[model samples]
Target: MTDLSLYIHIPFCQRKCPYCDFNTYAGCEADYSRFIRALNQDILYEGHTRHHPRVPTLFLGGGTPTILKREQLDIIFEAVDHGFALLPHAEISSEANPGAVDQSRFETLRRLGVNRLSMGVQSFDEDELQFLGRIHSTGDAIRAMTLARKVGFENINLDLMFGMPQQTPAIFQHTLLRAIDLAPEHLSLYNLVVESGTPLATWVAKGQVSEPDPDLAADLYELACELLQQAGYHHYEISNWARGPLQYDGLPHYACHHNLVYWRNQSYLGLGPGAHSSVEPHRWSAVRPVGAYIKSVEEGVSARGYEERISKELAMAETMMLGLRLVEVGVDRQMFQKRFGLDAVDAYADELSSLQDRELVSIDAKRLRLTPRAKLLGNEVFAAFLPE
Candidate 1:
């Protein structure tokens, strides 16, 4: 069986970002103690039920993982340690906020064996940060990075966003340059997306802000590709870049192994409100409301709001779509055949031929991969593989 990865969601934030529609709440500190207890029970229940699967990668994501107090975080991790038999060299990672992390918080994280720290420093420009409703200023972001390094965090990832309203090429370049100067082990370049019902989306609808321009976003993405590549960072995925010593199978040493589990369409168990899990025969998503989720888990009833047995056809199609997201480690032909009892070549020959003709994909003896041009037109290419 493929090694199982784990995802733990933190559903609290200091202030919500306008563009974010994730299941996170602000001013819910009163529920912190109760939430942690429920989360612990959720993790323990799943761990025992799943037979203590060996976890290689664990991620703490959400509204703001750093919003929790040190004792709360310690309790959560203690539950995890007791429930799951983490591998000797697990990639323990957490997403942190710049304004939320202090010396004490940083030390607590390091002491808990959180080897990888991903800071959500969306921009290094104060004006851009304010426009995006980020609570952290440029100075705060810098101090956070410095403190993280001083606390002995060698592996760090910085997230940068571009292509917002009134954002010119120069403005983006300035932020990108500062990020490159800080030199985190990994970087994720994201374009501003206006998801429906988000504050940004509402602003765009009301003409308070303009929607992001695809053409401008494309230009910025290309610019990032040029600059990051020049700085010796490998564009491992469509939006992610990393630089370090070589890792197994030619991956960058700092590549996000936990996310790679999702990219590879492997099994993972998520524990938290609104978390999702994909195991061998089924895929399910837990209830989104924190109160309801806690009640369900505490009562020893199912917390899952939606569940479906995964069909072989759906799995194969998802394998092709998700595997193609890895720029370098595309769908392996041998592994596909071994898992599904049929070669991907034989299964998707028609779709592959069409994609190759359009110059969107390439199929070699070992793997089927998306071409460089397919990065921009990825949705269209991936859609071709879906059963009609």
Candidate 2:
């Protein structure tokens, strides 16, 4: 009867973006049938071992889950349905690339019990989209959103990024306004991080591109917080905002439930290549290589290539770090005491006091949260919570 959240990674994409370093492959989608089989095996193994039959939330994320044909997508869902029983009101969501979206395809996904669609519409500006090396144009993204709405999709999320090379604050604000006009239920406003080993990193290294200014990015983030809140959206997490007053457990919860499982340090299972999973002290990630993951799962070997047992102190630190990301809820004092047998305020009194002195953290009898000024300096505050 454990309330488990399930995640399935679809590692196939039409092409990789210049900035992306996620474990996804381009031009290898022809082998999707084999990949689906491997994924099912991984799910079956997890279902059997965990003995948790009911799943409350399921998220299909990745390279472009919608890239698979309707029938191909069905095969994966069938395996999941057989392996684990979904709760009656489970939140079933799938991430899609705007370029690959189709009306019929979206309709089929809705028919197959997908309640949410998170579209990767990085930018609605042609220049920005091209700069990001995205295949879809602004027209394509608009058309995709229109089609999704027409096909009975009520709960939708748009994934966007800011702080790109040559992007001015004006242009970023324009993109945000355009996205708001479309009126998705959720918005993920992320700052572009230049990951090492990506094509964009090479561009920066070779002087072909200028990196985004951290100070400018901080200003853009603050602008987003201001604009989104004014538009009646709740800034629930650092990068996530949702339309106001969505009821969950009698609370005004507007955040993504699947991600909440991670931020709240709850247990969840991840299936497919490069997916990470955790159940209390034990955490594991699947083999990074698709071929290797398939081979191992097909051969009845565990897909996990790495595993770790988190220490109690580390877990407490992690909980504090993550829970504080929820700007509204923060870390509840009583919950921390119950879980760790110590007052969070007392355990990290020194760190909290230091941050508070700098006006970066605030604490009351009930919760510990970051101050508005500290939101941009979250990384600095989070680093202080790391186990020493």
Candidate 3:
């Protein structure tokens, strides 16, 4: 049986952040129970059709998965358990808002087989939190982290962002220092991108908010790289740093397994509205509207509304692009050859030569990786991989 990762989306949030454009709804009147039932039906149908029962990792991601009541979460877990043979030691992770989780909730999730908790604590500064329109205060974030530790969650990851309006190097450093003091198992440090359709975009366009300075963001990122490494965290992926060895697999470092599935270009199934799934060259996305997705599943239709089979050449280009995101591993030459039946170097010789000329990429016998300078300008190197 093929081992696959599972991504389950929860599209409900207590309040939507203006910077977020994910398919999420924020309101108290939505029928969560009915949605949960639809999710179960979708899972059951996929389980029967796919016939692959081995799941290495399961991630529940969303606007705020912890916003759902304990009972609703329970139903979803039941569905997962019934539909798939969850590995005994699979990394089951859930993304939670700092304001939405508590000691009891953490305890409940632990009992329900959630071994990893990723808290969306964008910043530890009160003013920054407010500026970002985050619902949780700095105090709330601290309290949530404390409760997660006290309730026996050792594998904790914090999601943080930089490059916000009014953000400076000093301010960002302060936030980084505070986060380091908390000492979570993993950290996802991301630069804030003002998505086109989000409210932040309107604010920027209207001159109500200033766009983040790219040069300053790069400086802050370099600072983070220096500090995190000094703090004994391994820079495993482009934006991820992991500290001690994880419980599962006893590896010397920890990384988000579910996301690694994407970076490694492996097969995975995504369930729930607006979720995207890629099984090799084939990719598909579910209907974005919650109501439409639920209705489709209930009427015995596939939730997927869009599908495409990626050409072999496109897949090879994608493999090079995604695999290079791993800071340490880079692209495994032998593995690439096994998958595509061609030498990566020969296939993209011209692009690689240009990139190497620019000091953007370094290719050794075993793998190809981004240089320190390339890490700052990753998009330029990745664009070179695209078919001209």
Candidate 4:
């Protein structure tokens, strides 16, 4: 089996954000000990069952992974090391909240072999921060990153949210400038997305708060592109930038390796409630409820809520769609041919031609990629390859 990335979901949160719709929950403090046990069991189960697949990267994501105490986090790492053999230079990343974290917290993280820190700073504007329901203030974010550096975290990524209500070009620019000034190794600039079932969606439905302006969102995205490029950051992927010209495996040295596994349509294993896994051909998601996931694992049953085997045609279409997200490094034509026995050019000739006619994509002997215009209308370009 191919070496795969590991995504471990930590579902506890200090409090739920109104605009958030992830599988995380609040008031689960009581379930923490139990869930931690179950999580480790789930990890062991996969390792034993899969004969200890080699792990290239591990991403600890959640409502707030930083919410856990250092000791709890330590045990989780021990479980991982025992269950799976992580490559020595593996990218071990953990998402952290900027609030309520002291220098000691980051030191513990380093001791646990978490080399990369992804801080969810969200926004620098206090009003926007309040609206987003983030636990940290702008000052808190800065302090956390500074402390992280003090404790020797060299690979750091700051996550910022843009396109909020009442946000303007000037306001978003300040946030970008501040983030750039910090000089983190990586940055993820994401637009606010209002998923259904979230309070933000309900607010939009009731007209309590106006919907996020698409035009404004696009403008902010453009502004970020310009500002980041000038600041010496490589626009590696949509919504992600990293200080580069530095190379890791011939890609951006600071680019998220775990996410690259997904972008490249490679195999991965997701452990914990509400996590999804794709081992090519087969894909599955663990059940969402904490108790249910714990019980299933305790009883030695698969915690999967649903599973499916995707068709090759569908997988090809998906490969094209996901590959284009890497703004700088689009799909590799030769690699595609090696994997599927058909060059992407020939496999989707008609679709490629149609997209080219629309000036949304460009294809060449070595690679196939979206045009600059297509970067803004990526969904439109991606939709062309759907298995219909």
Query: Which candidate achieves the best lDDT against the true structure?
Result: 1
lDDT by residue (1-388, candidate 1, tens digit) is 4578999999999998999989998889899999999999989888887788899999999978999999999988998888888899999999999989998999999999999999999998888899999999999999999999999999999999999888888988898899999999999988899999998998999999988899999998888989999999998888899998777676898999999988888899988999999997799999999999999988989999999998899999999999898887789999999999999999998999999999999989999988998888888988988987
- Cα TM-score per model: 0.98, 0.97, 0.97, 0.98
Model 4: residues >4 Å from true position, as ranges? 246-250
**What lDDT does each candidate get?**
0.91, 0.88, 0.88, 0.90
Q: List candidate 3 stretches off by more than 4 Å.
A: 245-252
Clashes of each: 0, 0, 0, 0
Per-residue C-alpha lDDT of model 2 across residues 145-227, encoded as one tens digit per residue: 99998999888899999998788889888889999999988999878999999999999999999988988888888888888
As for model 2, its CA RMSD to the true structure in angstroms is: 1.4
**What C-alpha lDDT, on a 0 to 100 scale, does residue 158 get in candidate 3?**
95
Single out the weakest 10-residue window by summed lDDT for candidate 4. Answer: 243-252
The TM-score that candidate 3 achieves is: 0.97
**Ten consecutive residues with minimal summed lDDT in candidate 2?**
246-255
What is the per-residue lDDT of model 3 for residues 1-388, given as tens digits with 9 covering 90 to 100?
Answer: 7887899999999888999999999994466888999998898778777784889999999978998888888888888887887999999999999988888788889989999999999898788898788999989999999998998888999999998878888888888888999999899998999999999999999999998889888988999999998988888788998987544432225688888889888899999999999987699999999999999999987788899999998899999999888877778888899999988999999999999999988999988999987888888888999876
* Cα-lDDT of candidate 2: 0.88
